[model samples]
Target: MTRDTQGENAPSDLDLTRLLQTLTVESDRYAERFGSRHGLHRTDVNALALILAAARRGEPMSPSALARELGLSPSATTALIDRLEAVGHVERERPSGDRRRVALHVPEAGLEEGRKMFVPLAEAFADSWAGFGPAEREVVARFLDVSTEAMKAVSAEWAPPHESQRRR
Candidate 1:
């Protein structure tokens, strides 16, 4: 019986770990370059990116909703929204139905930046995915979804005992 060379010659788990670390460092460098071009700290850029994406969803934006999406505290989310407002990247409006609630909407400038950052990311992912058929794409998507959920479960289960203290 002949054995497959691919399985026989596969790198060990440690090699995969090193490979992932290298990829993460490269990805961070890319994000840093993009962030520098936009004159934003990485976190600020990420917050603005999320806000613009939510606006594109065609639903009224709620600060609470954004907070939920980002896994951020309400106060932190408010602070982020405030920063965006101060920078003229976003504005708040009181919808007619709810005077007490504020809705976040991105200004044209914010949308433009979001577009600039998202275009390349989207294009790169699409280009890489072009090699996959529908079945393969579906399998990959399902695996990613399951992996994400599993990681979330593990994180939640092992919640740090002093997470709040550590944040300060």
Candidate 2:
């Protein structure tokens, strides 16, 4: 086998790292295209995804939580939320139980639009994984979970404290 730049064997950890990097770049490119098509910034698209995911998990996000997740300032997050709300893509609801707390939600139209945009990608992922058996899939899932944790840890380590935290 050919040696890599560090004199390591081909198809080693370095190869896997490069593959993951490529996957990230491609995913970002896809998101960029989607943002462009929908008249949104990349950050806006990311916020929408986070809000949608939180809603799906039955734990809706707040502006502050979104700011932390996006590493954005509280003001910037508010601006983003405003833009999304103006576009009818998101809404801020004050739950009846806690009138002071604001919950972010994607309107039904927004959900439908997102579903239309993502269904093709979801199908592609399913098709790609079709050849993998249960054992292989389990290993893949474990790898993904570990990789996600590692990334999150690194992000947390390097990220500066959010502006909201600075005020408190």
Candidate 3:
């Protein structure tokens, strides 16, 4: 009988919304732990994840491209790449005809370590999805895609990085 300001059910009382929010928080904690275990900073792990994602999509990532995706300056990205290279986590190469572009690559050892860390969780996810038929899985995928875009759009309108944030 009562309507909130939005004239809809409050998100706090929505099971799916709460579950998605909680998953986002828990996933952040998991990512932090995983990064620590791999001797990488959280952002470094995120960069590697992005690189792996691009590779999976058959589009290799370059240092400048990674900088753009990571929201880092060119100098900062170079420093990050240097650290990873020192640790044998990534290799730099000119994969394309553009000699000025530096392609980032995860060596076999790095890939193996990543596999060891993530394979179990990936298998569990796959096993869970195995219970759903193709139609159900498709619906779930579509929902996730829409949810992601909605969140992204909402995020763009949120308080952006101010002077205080930039100082950090």
Model 2 Cα shift for residue 54 (angstroms): 1.0
Worst 10 residues of 1 by lDDT: 158-167
Q: For model 1, what is the error of residue 155's alpha carbon versus the real structure, in angstroms, after optimal superposition?
A: 2.6
What ranking emerges by lDDT with the best candidate at the front? 2, 3, 1
Error of 2 at 82 (Å): 0.7
TM-score of 3: 0.81
Error of 3 at 95 (Å): 2.3
Which pairs in model 3 have colliding backbones?
A: none
Q: In each prediction, how many residue pairs overlap at the backbone (N, C-alpha, C within less than 3 A)?
A: 0, 0, 0
lDDT of 1 by residue, 1-168 (tens): 333446876556566456656766887887788778866677666666676667677777788877765667778888888877887777999999879998888878877876787688889989988999999999878956775686678776665545434446
Over the stretch 1-168, how does candidate 3's per-residue lDDT look in tens digits? 333557676433356677788989988887888888878898898888888888888887998789777778778888888888888788988866788767788899999988887899899889978889989989889978998998977875663455225437
| Highest TM-score model number | 2
> Highest lDDT: which candidate?
2
lDDT of 3 at 105: 84
97-168: candidate 2 lDDT, tens digit per residue: 998999999999988888888899999999999999999999989988998898888876776755346646
- Kindly report which residue stretches of model 3 are placed more than 4 angstroms away from their true locations once superposed: 1-13, 158-168
Between which residue pairs do clashes occur in model 2? none
Cα error, candidate 3, residue 45 (Å): 0.7
Q: Rate the local accuracy (lDDT) of all candidates.
A: 0.73, 0.87, 0.81
Candidate number that wins on lDDT, 1 or 2: 2
Model 2, position 167, has a per-residue lDDT of 46
- By TM-score, is 1 or 3 better? 3
